[model samples]
Target: MSRKLLNISIPVISVLLGLLAGAVIMLVSGYDPIQGYSAMLSGIFGDEYYLGETVRQITPYILAGLAVAFAFRTGLFNIGVEGQLIVGWIAAVWVGTEFDFPKVIHLPLAVLAGAAAGAFWAFIPGLLKAKYRVHEVIVTIMLNYTALHVTNYLIVNVLSDKQDKTENIAETASLRSVLFENLTDLSRMHWGIIIALICAIFMWFILEKTTTGFELKAVGFNQHASEYAGMSVKRNIILSMVISGAFAGLAGAMEGLGTFGYAAIKGGFTGVGFDGIAVALLGGNAAIGVVLAAALFGGLKNGALNMPLEAGVPNEIVDIVIALIIFFVASSYFIRWIISRLSKKGAK
Candidate 1:
């Protein structure tokens, strides 16, 4: 019981500490923390439109978080989720624009194309790591720049129509749902949220209820020991990266088919993939945890605009709060020590 409570309490306490630190900063900056927080909360839940926008934002965060979490669980650090996401976005938009199929076929096909593209992109790093002992961190990081340039070039040369953005995807390939729009006061929310939820469930099942999961986890725990135990570390590493990239790709698909319905040439990284690392850490790399963490992050991001407008606080303050939260989460050992001391005092 204590162990279970500890597991839950650590993150909650870390969040509280982060907020407290942010409050201090706000005080020093001559901003009203209470007003800022209140406005932020109201912004997130003020209307159906705001709520729907938060959910829309959460959709991709969930998938991206899952991507990082999955790789972490498999003993791989997949920093290239950003690159994978970009390629996936490009692939989905390409499929959506180039093809004209029935809605039933086109939407799924485009989404799948995104996932396949991400998987293929990750496969290169995976293969290199497996065959040559190359470090995945460096390889994936470099690939992020590669993905950005390659996608930008393709958009300019092949996909775009004399603009920086690709043409709107075919309606048949879109993930937007009129039903959700009606319910949410015409917000950009779409059926992609349903897909995100389903993928979360799928990840949970795959990680917790299967023999393959066990093998993958074993490889993560100790590659040499797993090899001695007859598990193929190389195969698991490749498989883990492919699966991780697929999740990130789905995140990109949510943007391409559901949110934007097109691809835009990016001058820089989308930052979603980088944020995934924080989400996975805060979530403890668990599927359900990732979902909740993503929602929190989504709420913060969605509500940031209102903080400036309603409370006269700079929206960048929210970024500071987020960074503090990550810092606290990273230094969770201090929190654990505090909990242990309090527990001993209570027992005494």
Candidate 2:
């Protein structure tokens, strides 16, 4: 098989293997895998409301996946996506609650606030990495804790000062849609999905169609070579992180403006950023791939809620399947070896 096909087959085979393994586990545990998965599929698509909820869940996931993928493509880990997203969420909420303007100006402005916060958060580590040769991972990991506690403190002291959540955003600033509500039986689906798709297009255009993108990729592959070619490595590194942080921040906006309509005190990580790592890996760090992977994850997560009602099974089974998918993706070499052996045996 061609190299590209081999690469593509790895994820596909991994997903299949994950499901198969789930089935084996289900049988051992005296549960029916077929019924469980059937219930999941039904939950995801059985009603218009469920379908809409599935899409809503997917919106932020696409952005989160893209954020991680963008940094990865530029040779950065961006472990601080969680923290950056949190700050962005609050920033957007602040704009939404504090401002009074036309929808045209207010909504976009709130969104921009989120992107800016995320970019600034990620920028710190990028600057450190480029200027001092400090590791991005270390700084980002610390920032995650700082973001959680700081945002909690901010919610309690700066914004609300009286409650765990901020005031509701004005209608002009809200992504919530009466039309979508009417269509989906009051599901929380919003226009955030549209924004996410646009961001994906933006990433694709930048990475594939511009000189700046070429420079970024060059720096990612080999900073020394990029510098030798007269490109400023530090600038590109910082720019990459800035762009990736913007995407992460946009993911937060989806929650603040679209999903929840307000910023609440978060006691812990949202898991969205961490899940993005798996999505990016599964998608191969490509825009279209991220969308597809996000859809799979979104469907699984949304549908898992119905397991108890429909299949008499725990929703955690889906979690196990997702974990297994990531495990297989991480163990790509072993999977490739198995595929190679199978291909050779078939050839004979």
Candidate 3:
């Protein structure tokens, strides 16, 4: 119980520390930190449009967060989410552009293709790690490069438009924001958010309410013991990686089908998959916690884009703040010490 409380308190304390660090940096840079923070808060929450953009920014973060959290629960670190996302994005766009089905059939098919692509991409590392005892961290990292180059080649060669970018997907294949426009007057928010939310819920159910989840957790805790108890540790490891990849793939789909309408030319990933590590840490690998953490990250990311336009602050300031938060969370012993001292005093 105390440990759980500490986990919750750590992020709160990290936020406070990050804000303080940001303020100090602002002061050194000869700007008012208060004004900067105020502007950031306002841009993210001041109006309906801004709020919608916040959610839009959050869409991919949610899925990415889930990807990382899912892997963490299984004692795996899937850094290949970037690769998984790229393949998923490519598969989704391919399906969306090639299919001529009605909305009901087309949309689901495209999304499922994305998921399958991601899962398949992930399975490679899972198999290597489980069967040959290769470290997943190394394999996933290498796969990131593979996914990047492979995706770049496909988009620029086979799928490229006249201008070298892929052609826009058909309207029927796109996830429309018309419903959100009616409510918030900001069309940026789309059905991707709904899908992300559902995925989170589904994962929560699987992790918290299912026997497979228990076996996975057991393996995460002690693979040797789980294997001794007749659980298939190797299979569970592969399954966990595949599931993690699928979530990452969904994130890629959100960025493509939901936002860009098609896969566009890219120098590299936008780092959403990498950012998922921080989100999962901040959320303590909890499903509901992932949603909240993603929202915070999304607000920070979106608001940072406007800070330069409004306050002359570099958007990288947000990255620095995020780094500080993650640093403090990783070194949460300090916060725990302070909390323990405070509690001792209160008890007296």
lDDT (0 to 1) per candidate: 0.92, 0.93, 0.87
Best by lDDT: 2
Measured with C-alpha atoms, the lDDT of residue 188 in candidate 1 is: 96
Off by over 4 Å in 3: 161-163
Candidate 3 local lDDT, residue 128: 96
TM-scores of the models, in the given order?
0.98, 0.98, 0.97
The clash tally of candidate 1 reads 0
Span of 10 residues, lowest total lDDT, candidate 1: 1-10
lDDT of 3 by residue, 1-348 (tens): 287787788898898899899889988988778778877887798788888889988988999899989999989989988889988998899888877998888888888888889999999999998999899999999999999888888888788753446777777777766878787675578899999999999889998999999998899999999999999999999999999999999888877788888887678777998999899889889998899899999999988877777787877888899999899988888888888999889889
Give the per-residue Cα lDDT of candidate 3 at 240. 96
- Badly placed stretches (over 4 Å) of model 1 are none
lDDT of 2 at 319: 90
